[model samples]
Target chain A: MASPIIITPAQVATSRDGEVVMLCLSGNWQITASPPRWEQPALDRPLRRIVLQAAAIGDWDSSLALYLSAARTWSGQQGVELVEQGVPAEVGRLAALLAPKPTPPAPQPQLADLVASVGQATHQLWQETKDLAQLLGECAYSLGRFIRGQAQFRWRDCFTEMQQCGALALPIVGLISFLVGVIMAYQAAVQLRQFGADIYVADLVGLSVVREMGPMMAAIVLAGRTGAAFAATLGNMQANEEIDALETLGVSPIDFLVMPRIMALFLMMPLLALYADFLGIMGGLVVTASILDIPSSLYWIETKSIIDLSDLSTGLIKAATFGLIIGLCACLRGLQAERSAVGAGRAATAAVVTSTLLIIVSDAVFAVIFNILGW
Target chain B: MNTASGKSKFAIEVEGVECRYGERVVLTNVSFAVKPSEIFFIIGGNGCGKSTLLRHLIGLKQPVQGQVKYFGRDFTHADRAGRQELLRTFGVLYQNGALWSSMTLAENVALPLELYTQLDRRERARIVSLKLAQVGLAGLEDYYPVELSGGMKRRAGLARALALDPAIVFFDEPSAGLDPITSLKLDELIRQIRDTLGTTIVIVSHELPSIFDIADRVVMIDSGARGVIAEGEPNQLREASPDQRVREFLNRRVAAVQQQQGILHP
Candidate 1:
């Protein structure tokens, strides 16, 4: 077996000989190592010529060609003639091959360009907002047609989506709501014990979970899970030209794809929220019974006494609104996605983020409206 | 570049190769040697595993049973570093151009140079422009792949593939979605590359014009036979081959052109 050859780092040194610059290259010029930067030799006289001597160079690759090209460029800039002496024929040929061609200069940024770009971005955002509004209006129109038995999507697909966003989501929703219940009850127990009002832990856990946490947590979970899925599915369809095929076949994607998803969330979200409320209360009962020594029957009675129909209805209404927001954001982002794999990924991320934001904002709006209504 | 044993006359050598997907065998006992600077074509009808064979040659997929040698070194059994060394000499142009959608044409072409060379930014840009110009895509460096038409995109892809001046260039269906004139121009470019630079070219295509215009030798794989059924110069094979399938595959375009001319004259 042959021993491996040791590679010396590439080096370039220069000397001034009369009006000519003597450039000597040594060592290996392989791509694995960085090449030394070329600097013009300092001379007091006007340089008439640059001579490249590469006889000492070991094994070489494209890095050598690049270095030689740099020397050629420097010679051009200094208006000096470059003469190759003993440079490998292949490297010399490569250096000549990369001879600088005239190309458009990189655009310089200016105040006008900045202002134009800003205006362009604003115009694009406005266009996007208008498109989203149009999509929502079309979705509403599709729903109306669906209710009238005239829409195009299969009932089986809608049921599948419902199962995806509803029944399939129960385990995660139950887990989150139950943890919320336990934490809320434990915190309330800490405060109420100071006032000798430990029984109120049940009221606090029940009322809060029913009115806010149950629906809000459930909606946020669905936004991350179902909304992202919807966006990814439709975005990939759009990327694959499947959506275009549907349009060509006289089927509106909004009717076939978006409406079914929206309908599934609409009917399933409130039911999920109600289920979450029960799980959360059960968690509260367990915490109170263990820590406060309250009987399960006593905790249940206190929870029933504090919670009313208006509170349950308010949570259900907010859950329904959140479902709508999630469905709209996801479908809008999917339909707006560009025809590429990266675009589909961006759509999924945007769906989760947008739907989650809208859910919180609408929940606050619901709080304000409910406060005014005194329900 | 000579191997440790000695220089191999062939640029690429495939011996006793078998290709399969799970249980389905696609090609078996496929053996061929591509000489240095030869324009080699792998031609077959639809679903004959032409691309599968190309994949094996490029090391995209390993053959179930065979040795693929590049320059006398075993490529299929080469370790990661060994394979990387062999791959550096390869330039592949996929059917759809496969230009990175996020990058401009200049960036697409410059990526290989950036990764493999220590050239400064300015020199890199110069090489990029030179390559783009070589492929007739000069001055459109700022344009994205989506902004260009099909022919321009393919040209941009060619520019990128030639970025490193690879010794071997593999093209997958170079003429697939192109108009006749554009496809012919691409064929001319392939011929020019081989004639001028002496780069070995391996192409997987069913395009008759491309095969006839540029291929120095051709290998036809048959789906039914599950291996290469014919190997020779395409024109000679069309005229003189005993295999009916090879003759039919190669002469179909000629027959069509003659029929068209006859109809016009009549």
Candidate 2:
């Protein structure tokens, strides 16, 4: 018998449904198209070997489009054939638009995309700055309108806020100031007992309450209680978009919202400062009476002699400035709020903290200025 | 602009109104007027200057150029007192409904009356209950707006708007992000408010369904259109406009598009 004829896989030209598919020596090449009409008939003879050559003469757009159309469509369904590991440069551009580019031919991060991202970040920063600027400008303009418009309303709100900020807040203020006065008198009594100057405790309590304890306690109380409340209220308003609602209501958030708070705090702060002084003095009276055994008559006599109106007025001025800074910062931050509720909280906390900082810094500056100017 | 003084008596007027945020131009020379007691709806795509334009009418945002007027008083030019006096005639129901979280619904409704009106506390409470009843929320007076549904919050806002018995009420995107049934209820409430209150209502929305169901006149403000391309009753708008955007917007929204589509003829 004649030796059986062997037709190797390479020699075979597979026709899919009778459309001629040229196989290459590499075993990877195959003609891809939409399942073609399959007009090409059977091969002339059994193939012996395969050779590869480019049949097309022109640009590969039509070929790429054909393959991609098939690939896109087949990929849309269940894919049948092996796709190339990476698209040809021609196909890559087309694929970029139609789908996310596949991995392996990783896209180099372009200078343009990086530049675009940087530009976006810069634009965002610039927008934030512009927003902050506009917010501040609006606050000032609104305050000016309020100052001009809110004559009676400001006083009313100030009185009401004073009750809220000062009278209602008095317990905490009084308690803390009282304790501080006792501590001062006790500390003085300890040191002075050895020096045979025990009665000087009355002078210590009297002087401290008149000067530092009054203003310092008042500032501390407002910072903790009133300042925080201001921040929280403003912050909540900011969060709730109530400020935006005010704007839409044609209510100048600054004028209608901020001005009342600012003016309220302004008027209230001095009254609060005075109340704090009275309570502080009362605290000192208790300490002087109990520890120093100095009578109220003597304590008041000494306090009146040393504590002039300027000392009181200086503290009052400082409290007013402190109130203004706290209310202004809180309201400004409130209006600067974004959508989230946390922003309002941050704004409120910031108001309290910022006011406390201002209270210190401004107090020192005012002290120097008043000393220099003889106010 | 001309009709603001003439026989037409524009209830609301915007003339050459320009608004911007930093460098980005939000609106450019948008000018239009709503007639007295008219149900005017301003419709546009997102970020297409709908809410911004609505804000200008109430003096929330001061326009960069020209003016927004109500009853011939320039809203932007007016001082706070002037604005407040002007504001007395209109109520704004903001996008969030702007109910105070700290206050209950009764307190929220009673606030404007407390601040602006001479109504006694008991009287204000009665009025608040009455307004809440009018919005189908009579029993929910004690609950906060926070506890209410989106639809309920809107209704509560409407009640608050009616607190001072204003002549006009402005709604900002009333149906946005709401379920269909809730949106439909709101649409009915809005129409009822107009028909019963006899109040001019201006709603800024792109929600096509609610806009057509209630708008006595729809003001279509596409960016490409010079300003407002179509203005008339909801049905008349579809027939009057040759613009494709207007037709697509109107025809689909309205039920009788069969005639417009020539479906009936064929």
Candidate 3:
């Protein structure tokens, strides 16, 4: 029968002799055991050399290498010679691997570099603007081709996109518009009640919901949902070489991929805005009935009287324009995406952010135009 | 001593495997056995289910109707834990290397060792260094996959695949994107790994020089036939295979080069 060998804890002891520092490493130096702590010897004396004595060291692994490398680094920094005595060949080799290699320093930016970067950024932005305009022109040309029945457009794909852009979006659009209606009606009720004119809450909610809130809310929601999806899907296809495959087969990506999505959104956005208007008005009716004691029939009659064809048409037209903006921004970012996973993610984010900004800016422009035209 | 059809002698055995995606059948009635320490090659035309068959062999996808046995144990029917135990012995190199873009080469190689072994950090680092050196990628351990060239990336991926000293290594189009010299070097490395380690190797490739250079036995799968059309030594198949398609595929490069030279010279 063999006896079991007893294990020993690792130890590091430091002693000074003249200008040389002696680091004594002993006992088992396995990583499973707790490592020994050794404080740095004082630098008061001019040290010429440091000796690592591992004569009593037992079975060891990376822990010993780690200790030796630490000593080596300290000696290098202190401008002293390091001497290894009786160390195993394996430990020496492992310790050598731990030695740090020189790396090139990163360049620091200067004033001229900053100016150059700014100039480069401006040039990139100008180029991107031109690309966006060219994409829109290509889309218009493909639409012309479709009208003449000469484009490679699939009705099935267009219908699928319509379903995604319209039907699947209803629940969220309905929810947000309904909440907006409730908030607006509550604010209106607070003020109108002061004058005992609570019945006019119907007129306020109806006009605003139909003219401004409905199209804006629906467009914003679709910008985040459908636009980001378009960018991500196309960006991934680009990464996987599927877009290149389509191009090699003589198919125009604008006619095949972009046209269907844009047409779907253009046709569906007005319908979605109309649906949102109805839901928002219904929410206002609920609030008015409960808080102001107004009957649903009376609220409906007042709402109908206040909201004319002009208000409805204004919201629908804004919605259609917003839809076009979202589609163009998203598809352009998708087509322009670099072929990588990170590029796909950036494309999706850029699509959502850019489309939302454009939607708000276009809505402001429409506000000015409508005001000037006295619609 | 021998029972149950003597399947234990072979390293891998596939019986009547059928591959399909939904209702579209890709391959049917595929059957083959690979002996221990053999270098086998699966060759086929583009989009001909060579990759699909490789996927089945590696237990990535289940065959609709058939059995895949690894060392006489049914891999297709193994439970999660049992399948993981079986998978630990296998290493697969994908067509594009597919090294994690975020990790450095050393970290990529160390991942499998960290997961599967109880080796200490120093020991694992030593093994990682050795494997990279074997693949001729030593001293570039800190380089990320995106920083390396395509050939270097593939070699690093091979190093990672060999991290655990797997019993069987699978290569999918190992020479797909490499120059001829680099691919020939890779073929040499593959043969060296087999000879030194006695590891079973199964490669999926259509590169003709690679097929003839390293393959001990070759199987040709035809897109139209939807199964293995011929199986034998590459040289013998070119000379004597009854299937005209097999002969044409094996001798395609020679005729292609000759016709190209004729056109250029004329």
Candidate 4:
């Protein structure tokens, strides 16, 4: 029969040897029974050593090791030595193994480390730029080959990409364009009415929507939607070594993989931009007629008088450039992706960021040039 | 030479390493070392973290504790120059034979040469052919990975891994998805590559036959122990291990075959 665990301070007595303090423990040393608390030995006492009287320890488990470990720690802090011989050999070994090592302090970032990281990042950026330029050159060469009927890509692929990039993008594009136009007209009406100039609201809405907002909004939507899709598809294929297979087959990946998608987006963006212009104008017309108390016929007349062929052509041109940017960035990032699952996701994110940035920068440059030419 | 003491001249040393995926600890307290030109095999049951250990050694992962070293230099803590030197010396063949799908076999072989070496186009092409020929893929240079059989894809992947004449190569489950005959051929090819190039090869596989045939030394991990339970020559472990768990694992196939025979006869 197993004895019940019992721990009492009275049972802990000084040994016949004056230097030792002994703890007498009986029965099962399990946490299920309340284990005895071992007090920290007094530093001022003549206690030079602490020992466990484990002769009565029956059916003990890890709780015994924990209690011994606590006693050892307390003894060490009080300049008292813990004699391991008194404890069961198994308990001693277990306590030693389970002891935690002191953790080292975390390293602080140094100025030198910061400078080195900056240097590394700059070099990486320069390398990426060179790679992107090389990819663009290769893509251009493939396009030339395509024009001369030398490229091997199927016409069916080009048409499929076109349908996916353009037709499939319509609903979201239409909804965004409508909301943008409505917001623009609502904001413009509040300002125009301040001077009783509400009649000029159509001119502001028509010119801004046709020349800038329509194409820019449409390009942003596509950058997030179509550009990310292209990156994800090609990046997944790259991870699976599908891209490597194309190279090994003596096929130019740009011609076989990228050319079709680029051609589709390049051909479709201007048409999509024109459609967005119509939707945005209709949205503005709804706000103008209902909120501004303007007649629908007069609103159309005002819009027609303010918008011209130059404004429409400029927006279409911008749309084409944005399409080229999105296609190039997406394909380049996808091709450069590492061979892993997370790598494909990272490539898609990079494609969206690069396409969005390039679109905004190119748009600014175009605005400056168009202003100079008075387009 | 004891690797834990940091006194051995080892090609790679993995000491007291632990691997975890999120909340689940996969492996713990694992330690081993490989010498130069040794064919080291890691064998384990399903989900025992054999591939995870390989990834940690290849620098694709950081161990939750402990460290991996290449010739006394810590892999994870190494500087960029040290890492580049390590990469240039190492080649990896992933399980699925990750050849770029868009490239021809010849072009795939030419890529690392183009990136890391200054060899001209003709020289690069010649080397590509030589490596392909080494893998018995001499004339199929224009074929894509998608067009190849499972064994052929692994062979092509091996060819690509050897492109830069790496000092060490790692293969993950090279016999997976291959028939017995094809797997035997692959084992022979792996031995040939090692003998000819004198490259240290680290293979993670559960194929007992291949392990016995190709491994200079084998380490068997236990999911229950959460660490390696046996380490020795395959024949030595099969014949002399005192642990019943090790004996059971080594004789598992024989026991299965006997049971099948018993069922058939009865």
User: Could you tell me every candidate's TM-score relative to the true structure?
Assistant: 0.57, 0.66, 0.58, 0.56
Clash count list over all predictions: 0, 3, 0, 27
Give a tens-digit lDDT track for model 4, residues A1-375. 999955532223335357777666766666776666666655565777777777765667778888778887777667777776457877877777556669898898666677888999999989988987998898888988888987766577789889988999999888998888899899999999999988788888888888898889889999999899889889998888566544433356798779888888888899888888888988889998999899989989999999999999999999998999899999998987887899889999999999999999999999999999999
Off by over 4 Å in 3: A1-9, A16-20, A27-39, A45-48, A55-63, A77-79, A97-103, A109-124, B1-266
Candidate 2 vs candidate 4, TM-score winner: 2
For the record, the alpha-carbon RMSD of candidate 1 to the native fold, in angstroms, is: 22.8
| Ranked candidates (TM-score, high to low) | 2, 3, 1, 4
**List of chain B TM-scores, one per candidate:** 0.92, 0.87, 0.92, 0.90
Q: Score the docking of each candidate (DockQ).
A: 0.02, 0.30, 0.02, 0.09
User: What DockQ would candidate 1 receive versus the native complex?
Assistant: 0.02
The residue-by-residue lDDT of candidate 2 on A1-375, one tens digit each, is 999954222122333333223422112222342222222223464332222222321224434434444444443443223334334545544543554446697688666787888999999868855764675586677666556774223345556777887679878877887778777777877888889876666667766676566777777777777777776776777666676665544455666566777777777777776777777677767877877677888877877777787777777777777777767666666666565878767776766766677678877888789879786
Per residue, candidate 1 scores C-alpha lDDT tens digits across A91-171 of: 877777677988999888666677888999999979977877898899888878788976676576789899999999999
Superposed Cα deviation of residue B166, candidate 2 (Å): 2.7
- What tens digits encode model 4's per-residue C-alpha lDDT throughout B1-266? 11122344897888899988667888998999888788999988888889888877776667889888876778767785567566666777878788876569998788778756899999999999999999889998999888999889999988888888876788999999899999999899989988987888899998988988999998999888889999988889988988666776776644455554322241
Candidate 1 yields a Cα-based lDDT of 0.86
Cα RMSD, each candidate: 22.8, 12.7, 20.8, 14.7
Candidate 1 wrongly placed segments (more than 4 Å): A3-17, A26-28, A44-47, A55-59, A88-93, A96-128, B1-266
Score residue B142 of candidate 1 by CA lDDT. 96
- lDDT winner among the candidates? 3
Summarize candidate 3's per-residue lDDT along A214-317 as a digit string, tens digits.
99999999999999999988887677544543442235789888999999999999999999999999989999999999999999999999999999999999
Best by DockQ: 2
